[model samples]
Target chain A: MSDTSFDSQTREASFGDYFALLKPRVMSLVVFTALVGLLVAPGSVHPVEGFAAILFIALGGGASGALNMWWDADIDRIMKRTQSRPIPSGKVGAEEALALGLALSGISVIMLALASNIVAGALLAFTIFFYVVIYSMWLKRSTPQNIVIGGAAGAFPPMIGWAVATGGVSIESIMMFALVFFWTPPHFWALALFMKSDYSEAKVPMLTVTHGRKVTRQQIFGYTLLLAGLAIGTGFTSLGGPVYWAAAVVLNLLFIKGAWTILRRDEEVAEADNYAAEKSFFKLSLLYLFLHFGAILADAVLMRMGVTFGGLL
Target chain B: MTFRPDHELHKRRKGRNIGVGLVLVGFVALVFLLTVVKVERGGSLQGFDHTQRIDMVPQGSNK
Candidate 1:
């Protein structure tokens, strides 16, 4: 009849706690882009293979998330944004996270190879390693260019999906990679502009914290312009069609406008308005990537139905 | 008594245990389905899991 003992038990690791270590939100993005990449590729995939490819790709992403939590536990304790993560909140042990991440990494790689081509499996393995080792361990706390480099880790899933179907890399896969890569800096810099305190407190040298907000805003604008050009240009490739072209034109115009608005504001105006422009830019970025991939998927479907979309070319 | 009372640790970790069980089951099923699909598509027995299964290969196989 001791409440103290039960109080301790209340904080013990549960299934949900372990799941939280996987960073399900980030895994969802990996799944979405990878699924789009698979569906939009030139060759056809067996449905089961496609399902297994996405599943293991997601597992690989989740494994990296767990390993990232394991590595960043110290800073997660300090950052308000990451304070409630499993390790920081004491629901999961760092060692358990390391174990789960490693185990899942091996299983996912092997299973993906068995279920699909070795190309996809190898890319998934490399993605996990790049995210956990290169980005999380090496670059994260060391440089202002961390997000720029780490974004490559997030951008690999779609490429891996493309590999699953075609069994090799291609121009379209590289384009998808470039799309996510260029989009990452602006998207993260916007969050950094508003959540400035988190990076400073954690001593993570984010672009905003190191280069100052004015420069960060400029970089966001610069990257957004590049992203707009790349996104609009992707529509003219074999990946693009009338459907994709329309989506790209509208999305990029809105995106460039958002980035321009962010670039125009100083911290004075941004803080006065509670970072409304920066926050909206962050929200739009989520849609920007999703709709770009969605448009590509729609184009692929139309092509499958024997409809020529070169009229708007 | 064949059915004894549950241990306190077991009672506390029921959800975790069940979740792990389900995951294990799902993994087995996925592997099974993958094997079936690979076989149905006329894939060789040697490279099923990306492993070189020499024993499964014929004796005179110059692969």
Candidate 2:
């Protein structure tokens, strides 16, 4: 008697596949930025509560990712880049993704509220709703500026972290939010530049698909300029230090140079040389944001010690 | 007829069950730790005890 008999053998989904629905990579970014937000704030939280705060924030980010996947399952099926995702690959059902997302979203918000503060919890709820409903359901298909508008969802982590500590927003927290908000366009448009035909094939209205490579390149340069200005200017704020200021200077210079190189390239050159410049720029963009936030974190840590600017640690 | 313990479904289900069991255990531990931390910090000690503790004051409030 095979009591474990099931109707469909092809539906043998694994736990890892269910986990895949959460988008771990994106969750890492959320965790990192949220941590920077918390660590740099004016006050401090107990380490255990801080750890719990980060965990629940990450859970919230993952929940939104699951919701995004559920909403974008159709496009995910068509996109080569996302073809092997849990839903697209048939490892997890679309409805299961939705249910898990909803469950996790509720759990995360409540837990964060209990573990941290209501403000952080409310912000997490808004972030999930914004990403799933505003970004995924509406803006993604409706406009080329989806990344710009939707980028706000990704930028709220640090602010939420700050709220967790200070229990309110401040100018310093806004600066942190703006840093990621501006950085998102340049970083993602660079990907859209080299990732030719993926967005087009999937019918997603990325800047490159809606406008053209030339305009997308221009937009990339434009956003890089904005990002550079803000990144460097932030050094004067409470979130900055000698370390962050130095990092900002070097990173922005390199980023601007890379964007300029991309701006000067044409289809002939890009095609002939295999988009090497765009690819490198894409890679550099990852490092650029990482190091900027890393510097912020480093500065915060250094300041927590008796360290001083231009003086011995 | 006999149920095969070594069946493929059993193997997969074993892994799934273990994963789910670990998550539940972790959640319980998390709640326990949270309760401990909250009680230690006087964040959740507002009920049943009428003692006025200073740590119970909201961090943002001027008590």
TM-score (chain B only), all candidates: 0.51, 0.63
Window of ten residues with lowest summed lDDT in model 1 chain A:
A1-10
The sequence of per-residue lDDT tens digits that candidate 1 reaches over residues A1-313 is: 4656665577678898999999999999999999999988888888988898899999999999999999999999998888999999988999999999999999899988888889999999999999999999999999999999899999999999999999999888999999999999999989888875777788889888788889999999999989888887787678988888889999999999999999899889999999999999999999999989998999899888888856435
List TM-score (chain A only) for every prediction: 0.95, 0.96
TM agreement with the true structure for every prediction: 0.90, 0.93
lDDT of 1 at A280: 94
Docking class for candidate 2: acceptable
For candidate 1, write residues B1-63 as lDDT tens digits: 498576554565998999999999998898888878877776345544665567766689796
Off by over 4 Å in 1: A1-11, A310-313, B1-12, B43-63
Interface RMSD of 1: 3.1
Tell me how candidate 2 scores on lDDT.
0.90
Off by over 4 Å in 2: A1-7, B1-5, B43-63
